[model samples]
Target: MNAVNWGILATGRIAGTFAAALRELPDARLLAVGSRTAESAEAFAGENGAIRAYGGYADLMSDEDVDVIYIATPHPMHHANTIACLEHGKPVLCEKPMAINQREVREMVEVARQRDLFLMEAMWTRCLPVIRRVGEWIEEGKIGEVRMLSAAFGYRTGWDPAGRLLNPGLGGGALLDVGVYPVALAHMVFGGEPTGVDAAAHIGATGVDEQTAMTLTFAGGGLAQLACAVRTNLNQDARIDGTNGHIDIPIFWRASTATLHVEGEAATVINEPSGYHFEAAEVMDCLRAGRRQSSLMPLDETAAIAHTMDRVRSAIGLRYPMDA
Candidate 1:
């Protein structure tokens, strides 16, 4: 039996979740943790029982014992941080919205290809058992050819204009933050970027979108209506309507469960594991097989989703402060 040594970079809320999930996988070890400040790194490491705490990113990448590094940094920092890890001959699993733009995605993929290291986006929702059931139902023709998809994910976050939610410098806004969930779902289930993009947004004083609504028209005439806002509350349900039947997912973005309702008969429910364990289990399984990337959450899928999201951002005139 082989074990995978994991190094985690970042010390935020999501990073903590990732660390906790990795701890549950016996075949995977939380070998080290890195943060901008050694104090935070030490704190996170102590909390998670990680073996080592690095003062900075370089230390984690150079620690030799780490077989993989999870890049859970902010959206704007993903490309740079991921490249640094790959340069150290470490595989990376970056969190979603891989970057603020497609150009950055290209750069990240380029570095990984150049180094021949495995790289993946932490689009964990796609790999969950519940979402897998949703996809399976579609494949089984439980839902006829997908005709329409609608999803809404939004919450009123009253963060200052310079905070993560409203700041342009932080790649802020509802779109890149919460909206990516709905967008990724549409792309993962429907396949490919939409043919047409139409959008309306409530732009904040900080030049970031506070609320956005978009309609994506696919080549087959199917439509996806996506709405995300930082100014309102939403139920965050996702529904896929087809010619025969429709499947609905509640709390769809982070869905731990889903229901398949066919044209007739009773609806079937699929439940999944808790939190980030689903993705962590996948990482451990891949590591045991000596594989770099998970077959379920490959880097290519992440890049494709990023590309579609790039287009969506353009159609809606959403630009980050880092945009050149």
Candidate 2:
């Protein structure tokens, strides 16, 4: 099989991590890196071993050899960047919180569908082996009717009004940055939009949420209590409780192991590699199969999760400048 030529559309930290993960895959090649300046693009290219570097996003979009473009820009840039790639007839794997709002996500997905181009939200957690095993266990009735889930992701950070974590203009907030993990996991395990969502947030002086909590109730009476914060250190753990047993997933976002506790049986611990290669491989597989979206992380599910987030924001009155 021919190697997939990957073009990275930003020089941020996440972009570098993804480049490293791509290098670990034999069927992938880092073809190009793009940034707002020639110097930054050249530097990223040098570090990532890319064959070429472009001074601007448009240049990267026009590159003929790039089989897929990874939009690793901040949350607010995802919609516009993904749209540009799809317009150029290039497949895209956009970073998480796919867009600032569900409206933008719908537009991005619509463009990809109209152009018959592959597009996927780069929610690596969905593609990880341990998370997939969680899904499998649920399907096999090992968990026996999952009824509740609890997840929390948080970390204390010093105040920086202009930084990505606190800036309203950058779509900064705990919800979009880290809350999406627990939200998406709930959607993945519960399997639909919540019937009701109740949330509260601590809107900081920067006009962005510093912390948030949510209670989601599914139609089938399943419940999920989730929390995310940028002002406190949280356990960053997750659990799924069922009629028969529960699964404990520590550091659930990028978890490599999970312990299953059956009602009256010895616990089983499952393990896998902790890396982003699985999601990259999934994107390549979709491209090779001529599929427009991943079955594992479908566009509809992405939009649904975004809509749920919009609801949470609405309930908490957390409006970004972009919403104005």
Candidate 3:
């Protein structure tokens, strides 16, 4: 089979990370790059070894050689970008926080469904080996009846209103950027949408959430405590506690190791290299199998996570320009 050709729709940090990951995959090819400016597109294409560089997204979307497109634009652009890709007959892997709001995610999902094209949220944590192991442990009853989950992903960065992290216009905030990691993980473990979302946030001077705390209640009485921040430092660890014991995952969002702590047994550690490659591999595998959406990161779950995010944002009174 011919290698899968990828077109990246941005020149951002995450796009670069994905490009690097694709370089490690023998079946993945970086075929093209698109950016707002020709210079940016050319530079990214050159650095990432993409064969084509387009000054605008339309050009990339028209590339018949590209098998798929990765929407790595800012949070707000995901909806339009993914739709454009799907309309042009290209499958899409959109960045996390799929869109600024749930409504937008639903629309994107609808377009993909209507067109019978592949669409997936780039929730890379779901593809991590350590995270998969955590899932296995829960299924194996290593941690008896998961009752609670807690996760935090935060970092302190210099204040810059125009920067993506703090810019409301860019859909910047801790909740959309880092909070979604924990939120997605909670959905993965609980195997469904949250029954209730209670949240609070610190809205900074830039009018975006600087820090946010969330409590998600699942139908089966499972609960998740999630926190994220841009102006503060957090432990960046996660714990899944059950009736028997708990599973501890450090840097859970990009976890490379996890410890299974049972009540009477010795702690068992699961380890693997962390990279964006695993998610890329999954996308390629699904494509080869003629699947439209990933079973591991289903569109329904992505939409549910988006709905949960909307609830969290509403609870915090956080509104972006993209929110309608």
User: What TM-score do all the candidates reach, one by one?
Assistant: 0.95, 0.99, 0.98
| Candidate lDDT values, in order | 0.84, 0.94, 0.93
Task: Give every collision pair in model 2.
Answer: none
Off by over 4 Å in 2: none
- lDDT string for model 3 (49-120, tens) is 999999999999999999999999999889889998999999999999899988999999999999999999
User: Which whole-number lDDT from 0 to 100 does residue 123 have in model 2?
Assistant: 94
Instruction: Give one digit per residue, the lDDT tens place, for model 1 in 1-324.
Output: 466788999999899989888877777789999999999999999999899999999999999889899988879999899999999999888887888887898899889888877887888888788888788888888888999999999999876987877888888888888888898888867877778888888888989888889898898899999999987998799999998889889889788777777777788887877478777767667766767677776667677777777777787788776678
The RMSD of every model to the true structure, in order and in angstroms, is 1.6, 0.8, 1.0
Residue 108's C-alpha lDDT in candidate 1? 92
Output the worst ten-in-a-row residue range by lDDT, candidate 2: 315-324
Tell me the RMSD of model 2 versus the true structure.
0.8
Better of 2 and 3 by lDDT: 2
Q: Highest lDDT among the candidates is held by which one?
A: 2
Relative to the unseen true structure, what is the C-alpha lDDT of residue 195 in candidate 2, on a scale of 0 to 100? 98
Q: What ranking of all candidate models by TM-score puts the best one first?
A: 2, 3, 1
In the range 33-149, model 2's lDDT, one tens digit per residue, is 999999999999999899999999999999999999999999999999999999998999999999999999999999999999999999999999999999999888898999999
